[model samples]
Each structure stands twice: as C-alpha cells, then as structure tokens.
Target chain A: MNKKIKDEDIKVILNSMDFDIPSEIDAKVNEMIYSENLPAGFFKKLLRTSNPFIKWVPAFASILLLITLGLIQLNRNAPERKPLSEIKIEYELKDKNIKIIWVKKENFLLRRLKK
Target chain B: MTLPLFFAGEREITEKYSNKEVIISFNKFFIPEKKALYNFILKSVSFSEDSNDIYQNTALRAFKYFRKFDTSKRFKPWVFSIALNEIRKYFKNKIQSSDIHSIENSYEQIPDTQNRELAEAVYSAAYSLKNTEREIFFLFYDSGFNISEISEITGKTQGNIKVILSNARKRVKSFLGSKK
Candidate 1:
C-alpha cells in the first residue's frame, strides 16, 4: 500500500529544503546602514570590532585599574615607622564626644609616589 | 566620549547617525526576521535580482512607517506585511504568475545532496501552485509561521488560510505520491 504522506510530514520535509539565501544580504544591509545612514543594529556593529586601538582599550583600562590599585596599596604600606615621640596621637575632648585622630605626615602620599 | 569611542564600532555607528536610538531599535527588532523574510521574498520573486530591491524596499518602508507601528503588537507579522506589499507592488504591472517554466530557468539546478530529488520534487509541486498558495505555503512551511500568523501577515481569516494551506499540502502530497 502506497501511503500518502501527511501534510505535517510534508511540512517537515519543507523545513529541510535549505535554499541558499543566494544573496549577500548582510553586505546589502551594511551598505544601507553606512551609506544611507540607516542605523545598523548595535549587535551587528558590536561584531565589527575592526579598530585596533578599540580592541586594546579593555586590556589597557584593566591594566590602568590594576596599576592604580597597586599604587594605593604601596601608599598604604609606605608609612615609615616612627618612635612614640615622632607619632602624634591627639584626642579632642568636646561636649559629650571624644574623638581620637592619628595625624598623617605632610606630603606622605607625595613621597610614596616619588618612590 | 573618549571611552565610548574606544569600545569598537561605536565610533562608526555614532559618526553615521546622531539620535539613532529609534533606528537602532528598529534594526534590532527587524533583523531577526530578515533571513526567513528574504527567503520568502526570494522564492516569491522566483529568485530574481530584484529580490534584493524588494528586500531593501521592505526594510526602508518598515523604517519609514516605524512610527505608526503599534508598540504592543508583534513586529514579525507587521514587517512581513510590509514585505508582502513590496512584493505585490513589484508584481503590479506584470502578472504574479507561479509559472513553473519561468521559475525552472531561474530556480537553478538544485545542488546534489542527500534528498536533492525529493527537495526538487517538493519545489516542483510548489512551483505549479498559484502565487498566493505558494506564498502561504512557504510562509507556513519554509518560514515556520502558523495559520493565524499567516492570517495576520496576509490579512486573510484563519479559516481561509487553513483551507488554502490544506489544499496546497494535499496537492503537494499528491505530486510527491505520483513521483513514487
């Protein structure tokens, strides 16, 4: 018995027809975007990362952030140990409040940067 | 500004159009539909060179009328309707015929593949159908659109689309059976 294929089965076969788009659709789209000033989709624009400097910017920014953190760490660790006489610990007695403060050496951050 | 430009292709996009958020949104919404839509158009035009023109016109028209588009409704069928209009406009002067012979010359030889014979036969059956039938058939099958969606795109009732699609499939099935 030759059974006729069901419509659903025929539809499934049509799915695999796999026609080649047969045209440079994206190229045409890009041409419209750039030449006609039509907005190219950001996702598409994101994929075209051709600029060398732009590509390196992320690495450069990360390196800069790392260096800044390193300098801050160096400044924090650069404090010279001082004898009890040289270190000034001041306590301010005010109305109902007592605040203890450690005085920072003048130009301490500047000296750390010089290192 | 310096940081923004550093992020690859931003400079190009910004340099092209200022206040492009609307266009960007339009492209984002429309691009996903492009390949399926283009394939439908390509088949509709019988893979003619003007298929590109129809495609471009469709996009441009979509962009042009983008403001009037209801934000709540779906974009796919709306954009498809615009494309359908472009296809119809292209065929206004000449007949919108699904003549198998005209399509055969332009259809090119289907590449040798596992199911090439069956694919060719399926396409042959499709070719012999009326223009409207083939359009709905491809949208239903090739483009994977459902009956109501086809109705939305074609402005036909769901029942009407189902009947057309049913008839189209039966004819294709008959043709395929005759092949065996």
Candidate 2:
C-alpha cells in the first residue's frame, strides 16, 4: 500500500518533536547580559559627546550652514539687476544700422568704428 | 517569530545609552526566539552541557553585538547564522581533540504515546538527511524560514538551497513512504 504525506503532517510532527530546554538556560543568559549592565550598542558610542565623532558633526553642520549663508550673502552682494522696464537704456544711431547702446546713467563715447 | 519594528521613528534610542528602553526592545525581539534558538543548538551540539554553553555563548554574543544587527532585515536569519557559526567553531575544536562529539543525538523521550511516536517518526525522517540538508530541513519546518532566509543563514545560494532541500524532502518522503 502506498501512503502519502503532506506538509501539514510534517509540520505537526516536527513541531511536536521539540526537546525540553534546560531551565537554567534563560537565567544564565540573563545573568550574562545583566552583568554588562546592558549593552550600550555600537552606534550608541556616537551619541556620547565625549566621542571624536561628536566634535566633527557640529563642525560639518556649521560648514554646511556657512556655505548656505555665504551663498545667500554672495547673492545679496550682487547688485540687484534692474528689470528691463526699470532701467533706461539709451541708443544713439550713428548711421542707418549702426547704433551705440549704453546704460543711461553712464556716459560712454563710441570714438571710432573698427575698420 | 518576527520582530517588532524596534528601530522605527526612534533611531536615537538605539544610538543612545537608554538602558531600560534598549533592554525592553532587546527582550521583545529575542525572547520569542529563545526556545527555537535553544532547540537548534541542542540538536546541533552533543551533550546538554556543551549545548548549554553554545546556547549561552550565542545569546551573549548576540546581545553584545545587538547594535550591529541591521534593523531592516529579519532577525531570525541573523541569529541563526550566529548559532551556526558557534556550532561550527565547536565542531572544529572537537575535531582537533580526536574524539569529542558527533552531532547531538540525545532525545528526552516524551510522556504521551501518540506524540512520542510522531516525534520518533519525524526524528527518523529528519536524521535521514545529510548534515547541511538536515540543517535546512530544520530551519524550514521548525523555524519556518523561507528559502532566501535559509540561504542567508546557511550562506548557500538560494538555488543550491532549493536543490538540497528538494533532495532532502524526497528522502524524508521516502522514509515516511517506507514506514507504510
């Protein structure tokens, strides 16, 4: 006679086959962990202000902030460009198509036309 | 069993020295896996004493390196990998000594007759597998780890795990088939 087994049967059979865990296993592990006063973790070291990493973090952040602020300051330092309608640009026609263009505020003379 | 999203939103908790919170999260993450972890160690190492030592070492090492555990991945495979390494290290030492342990064979007999019989049958079927195949089999049925997770734990390719598991399954089926 051919007999077949299913996964469910295996699962049930296997799960039921577990060994009795020694009771002291938990206590021993607990004692071991507690002895360390709990692990502070690897990344936890960075949280310490005493760590070298903390010193550089502020410096990096300040550098980034300064760069952003400097960019803004540099932009501010640039003369505000007047809109086309705001500033007057004057052009005097010397000939049919030849003209001199200059900002109205500045006096510039077109002395000689290049040959 | 799956872990709670321990590092969600409050990553600083892990990166800080908050002992109480860290302890709670660690316990929450590790407690449910305890029995399974112990059983795996027990099945892998001979002698209850040595198994206990391996078990303690695996747990202690895991705790000491808890921060190194990636929060995004499954904890089962990570812990399983550590347990496997510990078992290997034990065996390597045993091999040098000439005579120490041959992969744990002690079983505490169960009281109930029907369950005991089933346990014996399952044990026989499981033991019929090759060493690596047997490890995969236990990880599959006992811990419910999928192929990918078992691959990660065992450091075998997923394709290799599938082939090994399939062959192991055929053997187990044949073992069960023969019993009829």
- Which candidate has the top score in TM-score? 2
**Model 2: CA > 4 A from native:** A1-3, A37-115, B1-15, B18-21, B46-49, B100-104, B109-112, B177-180
Instruction: Please state the error at residue A45 of candidate 1 in Å.
Output: 28
User: What does candidate 2's lDDT look like per residue over B1-180, in tens digits?
Assistant: 432434222454444546555567677778888888887777555324588889888987777566556767877788888998888788778779865545445455434656666566667778767778878888888777899899999999999999998998889888877887
* lDDT tens digits by residue: candidate 1, A1-115: 1347666666666666455544576677656654656555633443354344756878999999999999998888666877553356888889859889886767667878999
Q: What TM-score does model 2 achieve against the real structure?
A: 0.62
Candidate whose DockQ is highest = 2
Q: List the residue pairs that clash in candidate 1.
A: none
lDDT of 1 by residue, B55-84 (tens): 887877777566446678999899989988
What C-alpha lDDT, on a 0 to 100 scale, does residue A44 get in candidate 1? Answer: 46
In angstroms, the error of model 1 at A33 is 4.0
Docking class of 2: incorrect
